[model samples]
Target: MASNGMESMQLAEDQIKILEENFNRVSKHPDESTLMLIAAESGLTEEETAKWFRLRNAQWRQAEGLPAQLGSVKD
Candidate 1:
C-alpha cells in the first residue's frame, strides 16, 4: 500500500520536471500572460503548478535520485 503511494509521488515528480521546463520556456518575462493559461491547460491549479516546480527544482538535492526521491521514508 505504502509503495503504491511512493510510486505515484515519483510520477508526480517526473511530471513536475516536464512542467518546469515548459514554464521556464514560456515565463521568460516572469509575468507572461500565458502563465495562468498554461498552468490551467496542464490540468494543474496555479498553486499546484508552483508547488510542483519547487519540488522539481529541488530534485538535485534528492539523494536517492529523481525516481526515488519520494520513496517510503518510513519503510
Candidate 2:
C-alpha cells in the first residue's frame, strides 16, 4: 500500500517490447550511458529504466536462490 506512484503504470505493447528487448540484452545492472540510450529509444525516463532493471534483477535473484543484493556493493 505504499504510494511511490507508477504502481499503476500500464506500458503499451510497443513499449513492453522495447523494454523486454533491453531486459534480455542486459538483465544485470547496465551502465548509465547504455541505460540512458535505452531510455531514449524506449521513450522512458532513465529512472524508470533503472527501476525496471532493479525489480527484474530482484525477481531473477529470487528464482535463482541468490540474495537480491548479490551484485550490489555495500558501503
Candidate 3:
C-alpha cells in the first residue's frame, strides 16, 4: 500500500525500459489498441499502462515548460 492508502504499483527496471522506449519512439497519446499491446508487452493491465502514459506525458509536458494539465490524453 502507498502512503495515501492506495495500493502502490512499482514497475521493474525492464518494464520501465520497455515503457520508456515506447514513449520515446512511439506516439505519446497511444490509441486503445496500442495501449493493449503496450500493456501486454510490459506485463501490466490496460488501465495501468494508460495511467503510466498519462503521468509520463504530464511529466514530459512540465519538463518542456508546458502546463501538466494543458491537454487530455486523447489530444
Pick the TM-score winner: 3
Off by over 4 Å in 1: 1-24, 27-34, 60-75
* Model 2 RMSD in angstroms: 3.6
Which residue pairs clash in candidate 1? none
lDDT tens per residue, model 1, 1-75: 233222244436555565766756755222334556656666667655555544543443353355634444421
lDDT of 1 at 4: 26
Score candidate 3 by lDDT. Answer: 0.81
TM-score of 3: 0.82
**Model 2 per-residue lDDT tens digits across residues 7-71:** 45566778768877887876477899989988898888998877777766766776899886676
Off by over 4 Å in 3: 1-8, 72-75
- The lDDT, on a scale of 0 to 1, for candidate 1 is 0.50
TM-score order of candidates, top first: 3, 2, 1
For candidate 2, the TM-score is 0.72
User: Candidate 2, clashing residue pairs?
Assistant: none
List the lowest-lDDT window of 10 residues for candidate 3.
1-10
